[model samples]
Target: MTGVVRLATRGSELALWQTKWVVSLLPVPTEIVTVETEGDRDQERSLTEIGGQGVFVKEIQRHVLDRRATIAVHSAKDLPSTSVDGLVVGAWLPRANPFDAIVGCTLSELAPRARVGTSSLRRSAQLRALRPDVDIVSLRGNIRTRLTKGKGLDAIFVAAAALERLEIQPPVVEILDARVMMPQVGQGVVAVECRADDREMIQLLSALSDRETELSVLAERSFLRTFGTGCSLPIGAFAEMQDGTIMLSAMVAAPDGTRVLRGSLRGEDPEQLGGLLASDLVERGALALLSASEGKG
Candidate 1:
């Protein structure tokens, strides 16, 4: 809490922007230490093939664990549901637009067999469930790279928060409803991780935590955690506080989108609400869909 705090983050444009935002809020001066994660190194391979949930965050966390950085900044969606033993998320920035946006064309306007690009299995499964005729191409990279690669495709899915953070707006942007596409856990939140035993650092970062955002993200993450850590299947969860109660919605689907188990639950305790919702889905055969997805993997 005295000298400059080193922040570990990815080198991508969005990652830098997110880290810079954290720096702006910190009381102490900061130094950003950009680390190349496996996800950033191998953009060609699907995330599942490259190690799924933690692909973008493990290396960044390592920087903090090694004391190379005081904290690790990450797009919360990149983090796996399981907590790292030595690292802890100290702060949750205020949530942004927790919705997916379709660029280039509206969902309804796409022709049959139109190619749509996205790397997220959650998005792919939901899109397939909605438009089985369209092709879900494997597309990866930063926001700009994905936009550029989607030139010939009918459309591409991007997180609405990413575009908003970078202030880039395409000519055609259709924000998908949560009902149409439940967002990934922690989708629009920024998480700051630090050494769990570093009391000073944890205190400094915790001061910046947003209560409402923290609760919602906690609920969503709890829902995903019930499924297990490092789960790469097509699953999504979103939580919001309504009238002092937490309302959580989630979905589990087959990779081909043949079957999707959707459910919602409400409770005051975020963790309990998430667990109840996930348990309900499992009882309804969500585990079968997860097993089928694992078989494909």
Candidate 2:
């Protein structure tokens, strides 16, 4: 309803797609303002090597903080556990698939001791949990690159929503259910960020917010924040709404995925439930795993 509301977004194809999708839900005229963040330009480095997944969101957040844009859109998983100064999550849209998909090859058909490409500690840890025999390697770059380089890989794990959004049709070997491998906190969700005190913007975004998705991810993210492991940690967490109850599962593992601890908690309140789930995991030795793992942001 306002004169061209500027929306800040990263230049990645996936990020653009997410931004455009969110924009479509808005009633006001929108001007998509793309910014090339460091993560987009540096394809040679791993996300952990740069600034973790935050590399993809920091620049766009800058636009919001600087008042260049009314809001910044991001894949919630890419954000840091800590909230940005001067900004807050105004809205959380409905989540997409939060499960990790085994692509290029099915998990069963992959050769013994087969090389699997993935840079996510979460994925690596989960894969190791399922099949400790497989080799895990750091395969960086975008989804397209990983899939292309997956020629030698028995398989690669990626977010199912991403593959679907990109219209990728790799014979997905298997879509690992969250019960097997909990997803990263905030995975499969998009968050709208705006100035914390901007009542107008907050109200606009609230219209798009889905309460169930918000509560579920809130619990998941709270669990992550409680653990104090940022994006670089080999941490996987996911929460689902079942019968009006939120069931959360989470796990933490060593970089090699040899040491892992997992647990679950269920409740109605996202933050409280997530905290309980995290405590259960910590009691099961998650803290020790985080302590041993290097580069756990």
Candidate 3:
């Protein structure tokens, strides 16, 4: 609190935008430390092949743990469900539009055998389930790069929040409803992490946290944590407050979109609601779907 707070973050355009927004809200001086992560190094490979869970965050987290940075900023969805041993999320920014958006063509407008581009297995699986006739192309890169690559494709799926944050508006954009496509856990949220022992830093960051967003992310992440650390299958969970209770909806699917399991639950405790929903889905054959997908991998 005495000196400038060094905020560690990825060098991506979206990442920087989110971090700067955080800086704007802080009452003290700040410095942005951009770190290129594993996921940034390999745009040619799929996330699962390049190590899915922590590829984008480990190095950025290392900066904080090693004292090179005071805090780490992350697009919450990029983080693994399990927390790092020495790190803790000090704050959760208010949620944005937590829904997938399609650019170039509407889902209903695409012709048979049309190609849909996406880098997320969750998006691919759901798209495949919805339109078996269309092709799910493997697309990768930053938002600008992806938009350039999607020129030849019939459509490309991206996060609605990403488009909003970057202020990029495609000629044709369609927001997919959560009921049609559940979002990834922690989607549309920005998380700030610091060392668990940094009591002063934690207290400073906590002042910027939004209670509703924290509870929603807590429930969604609890559901994801129930799936374990090595889960690479197509999984999606979304949580929101309804009256005084937390309502969570989740889905687990095969990579190929053959079998999908969906469940939901409401409770006053976020973690309990998430865990219960996950358990219900697992009991209804979510594990078998995970196994089949892993075996295929």
Candidate 4:
């Protein structure tokens, strides 16, 4: 008798949308169980203070561990760097745009010192690098909230995938090139997690895993782990496979974006290639800016 797979996720519109998309591709029946996460509870606080990368994922993971849910679905970018002992990532779905978009009220817009709202330091820093005159401010909430409250800021920055999922046409979206604005590790990918011993569920999800996204995210995660930067750090990485070789680009910056260190490395081995790229950046003084970015000495 095949049991139903209970997938745990936050109840946010985007989160549920992602889960439904994954479930659509699977053969087995799925039951969605919404778990309110720390991030959802404290929408006013910065993610770093509320619990960092795992704030949204921990609750879903807990549901799986407690046997209340057979699997957990999460935005791959929000996952913790270290793998949990009791669970395994059963799949990494094919990625989306994986780029930041600058959205404004009009395509032809110009307001010096215009306020720009964003929750991520990575996006803020990259925007500063490109347009230092804009005033960057912290804005956190679901897509609907942010867009509704977009009154104060002249514009905002958000993931392209999120906007597309919502089916809302951003008034104007300036998509930054990946070479200029590297994405966070695992961005635009969805991860399905299950208890390591759930062989049946694992086999089902394994079929949905995208090998290219898996390898690329693996490399990006390795790079981030080696650097030891948290979500608050002004760091970004993006990796891709090019003609059977892995190429990784990464950056570390002072929070203010006044100083930044960027570099890349390539190799046949994605993990090793990422480490080499991170090490090269470290050797060339990336640690200095990374430390400052993290508010460390």
lDDT of 4 at 6: 86
Q: Considering every candidate listed, which one attains the maximal lDDT? A: 1
- Misplaced by over 4 Å in model 4 are 105-110, 295-297
lDDT of 1 at 273: 85
Output the TM-score of candidate 4. Answer: 0.95
Candidate 1 is scored at a TM of 0.98
After the best TM-score superposition of candidate 2, give how far the Cα of residue 92 lies from its true spot, in angstroms. Answer: 1.0
Instruction: Return whichever of 1 and 3 wins on lDDT.
Output: 1
Give lDDT tens digits, candidate 3, residues 120-206: 888888887888788888899999899999999999999999999999999999999888887889989999999999999999989
Q: How many Å off is the CA of 159 in candidate 3?
A: 0.4
Q: Clash number for every model?
A: 0, 2, 0, 0
Give lDDT tens digits, candidate 4, residues 1-297. Answer: 287878899999999999999889878878999999998999888887776769888989999999999999999888877788899999999999888777874323748778988888887777677778878788999988998777677988778789887887875778777766778888888999999998888888888999888889888888888876557677888888888877888888776778777888887777787788888888888887766765321
Off by over 4 Å in 2: none
Candidate 3 regions with alpha-carbon error over 4 angstroms: 229-231, 295-297
Ranked candidates (lDDT, high to low): 1, 3, 2, 4
Can you tell me which runs of candidate 1 are displaced by over 4 Å? 229-231, 295-297
lDDT per residue as tens, model 2, 1-297: 457788999877788899999889998888899998888888776677787758878999999989899999999998887798899898999998888888877777878898998877778776787788988888877778778888777788888888878888886657778777778889889999999988888999998999999988888888988876666778988888889999888888876678778788889988888888888878888888887777632
10 residues in a row with least lDDT, candidate 4:
288-297
RMSD of each: 1.1, 1.7, 1.2, 2.0
Model 3 whole-model lDDT (C-alpha atoms): 0.89
- Total residue pair clashes for candidate 2: 2
